[model samples]
Target: MAGTGKAHLRSSDNAVLRVEDLVIEYPGRDGSAVQAVSGISIDIVEGETLAVVGESGCGKSTLAKGIMRLINTSSGSVNLLGTNIAALKGEALRTVRPKMQMIFQDSISSLDPHLKVNALVEQPLKVWNRGNEEERKAKVRDLLTSVGLDPEVVGDRKPTEFSGGQCQRISIARALTLEPKLLICDEPVSSLDVSIQAQILNILQDMKERYGLSLMFISHDLSVVRAISNRVVVMYLGKICEVSPANELSERPLHHYTHALVSAVPIPDPTKVSGRAVLEGEPPSPTNPPSGCRFRTRCPAATDKCAAEEPQLTYAGNGHYVACHHPRA
Candidate 1:
């Protein structure tokens, strides 16, 4: 039930990353073009973290990839720092590469095992010729230390030798080497232990404050998102179902799909039981998604109108927006 609308987004002047009507499609099963992301418009203000959460096949990762231009998009504009990077190409695109960086879900796999940790962190600066040899090394040490890694101890080691948490720390240091304005993290702490997850998250928050970074964080961990993000964007089958402030979403979700996701997040206390919104069956195919409301296949409040016409994202008051035929109010 997602349609084109910009009501959910803030002023472009206040946003560091603004995506308008973004679409990303590619070949799927039987050669059908799978619309991975369909007409998504979202923005992240400077020094804010916008978290995108949904079920596995909801295209959360694809949306991040599309904005980063790690994969080519079919059509749309990705405006970063007042410039539409989606339309830029060749030398121009390469020139702006340092302004943005992405951290993958797999920490170890994302880093280079062949290179030492110090070299790994310094690589980005070297590529862009940001500083002289000594200056780069000094900057790398400062960043590694900022991430809670001792440069003296772990600097000469490769990524494989370190634990999952340490590898993620090294990745973060590398990402910050160029002082990127925007960082896209694809479940950066999902693979680590719970304690490790907290450590990494703290590191991220510290880095964000230190560098004035705007973040687009994609994760299935709603708890983490609510704790760290300024705002949350609930996605469903390549479309955004809701956009609300993080605490506001946790307390009062509107969209049926968003409600389901919020309900599924386990409550911290065991003495009190929370109501569950159990979704039946699996998600429909994205190659040929259900007409009208894509979440209708699994939504309980779906009706003939939901099947006939798509819902546009409309303001639901108090800085909340939802796209649904029957919002939870």
Candidate 2:
């Protein structure tokens, strides 16, 4: 089904990245394939953050991997700076990869625990063969300072010696080594404490502004997505349920699945208790997704048509798009 979401935020004159009907699948038994991301598409404008939010196992990370060409897609296309990434091979892919970097969820996992911070940060430069030893060292110092870390002390330490937040900073530095135009961050802050999350997010915001970078930020947390995103895409079972401006989606979610997600965001005010649409049971397996609407099983407002005919994502209003037979709007 064609998703009918239009760009709410003014799209840039030139789209930095475009993903069209991208489908990713893993090999299954008997030559079948388990679909991970199914017919997903989005655009990343320069200097803007596009957040992809969903429940665990909704293919958020898989989508990120597909965009970066880490996982092969069954069909569809991903274009970065006018190049079809799916069609790229060998030297072409190698040439393009440095321009699109990913920051992993686990800082410790992304970093080489044995390597000192300087070595880790300089690793990208070394791989790209950017310069000699002295130039690489100077670049590492600049990267550390840019991410609000001390070049002298922390640069000499190992991943094991730093805090969770600091390690993430190092990971960010590694990502910045090539001065990439696009960054795909897969829940980069989910592993950190609340205070640390704020700091890291702020750093990202500053860097994004400074560099005019386009970001594809994937996370399960709605509040975090709302904070940093200009636009948000809500995913359910390997499909996009809704796409809208961040504030618009947060304030008025059109799809039942999206409403459930936004309502579940924690509200700190005790007196202003939220009346969230509590979903029942766990998300169904993607191995054999439910017929029609994937979320119908958990949706309280599900109807007969919801089980018989899947809905296409259509515009509700103001460019807000939702895919539901009976949208909340």
Candidate 3:
């Protein structure tokens, strides 16, 4: 069985993952393409949770899938654990894939309702040939117990028998079965109830520390990201708008689009805060994204400069980064 409780696997001495100018596009009808992620770059230092936050259709999921090689990159490089994922192919890709895993948004759809929990958790072990049948069964029980589920009771049951939160825990257990070094969580808690979301978050935090995991968490919930992520990356129309330490990004956002998103987060004290900013409009279509900055249409600080030249991510303060010509400072 894999070691539990802070195994200390992170290489703090170097960045475990690096993405440079990553781009993904899907061919469409009439010889056109829809750019899903456009020239995005990010670095994930070992053992850190980097949260990617954005509105719907902002390409957060696409970026995560791109990093996992679920979707082909049109251009750019994704280097994880010192391997260029874009260039990996066939057996090489399959060999490298075991180190990275993903947990999707809807646990309901992700799980196989037809399969029992024992089979579900043991699937990875079977595929990897980690152990004999008896050993695989033992590992499955251990995985269930680690996730705080009753191994005896849940192991024989099907996914359809569990609650939404329970189903998510099962999904997490399945993701961990591979003993992945990097886990990409795409809106893991978005589909749960408000109260259940907290429970799921606590479980995820526990798992992160226990497994010495590096995470790329994608979500639209800023509050949840603030609570769980060590660092933050904000995306707009398939491009990164800002990147910063979680607390710093929440308190001192730089990009106008990021600022608007920060302002929209509900303050604990109703009497102390007001003026929730409603951005001017929806995100532009990826197929026909605007020139220069994609956020110019909705950003209050947008100017002629923003509409003329695209901005590269640059340091703002205390490791914070922004990709806007007119950052809020």
lDDT against the true structure, each candidate = 0.90, 0.85, 0.84
Whole-model alpha-carbon lDDT for candidate 2 = 0.85
Candidates ranked by lDDT: 1, 2, 3
- Supply candidate 2's per-residue lDDT for 222: 89
Q: What is the lDDT of residue 168 in candidate 2?
A: 88
Per-residue lDDT tens digits for candidate 3, residues 1-329, read: 00011111234357778887788998877789988888777778878899999999988999999999998999988988888989989999999888899999889789988999999989988988898999888888888888889999998999999988999999999999988989999999988998999988898889889988999999998899999999988888888878788999888888888778877777889688577777766887888887888888887877888788887777666877777787775
Pairs in clash, predicted candidate 3 = none
Best by TM-score: 1
- In terms of lDDT, the best-performing candidate is 1
Which is superior by lDDT, 2 or 3?
A: 2
Query: Which residue pairs show backbone clashes in model 2?
Result: none
**What lDDT tens digits, residue by residue, belong to model 1 across residues 98-151?**
999999889999897899998899988878888889898899889999999999
Candidate 2 backbone overlaps, count? 0
Model 3, which residues run further than 4 Å from truth?
1-13
TM match of model 1 to true structure: 0.97
What does the lDDT read for residue 226 in candidate 1? 88
lDDT of 1 at 245: 93
Q: Model 1: runs farther than 4 Å from truth?
A: none
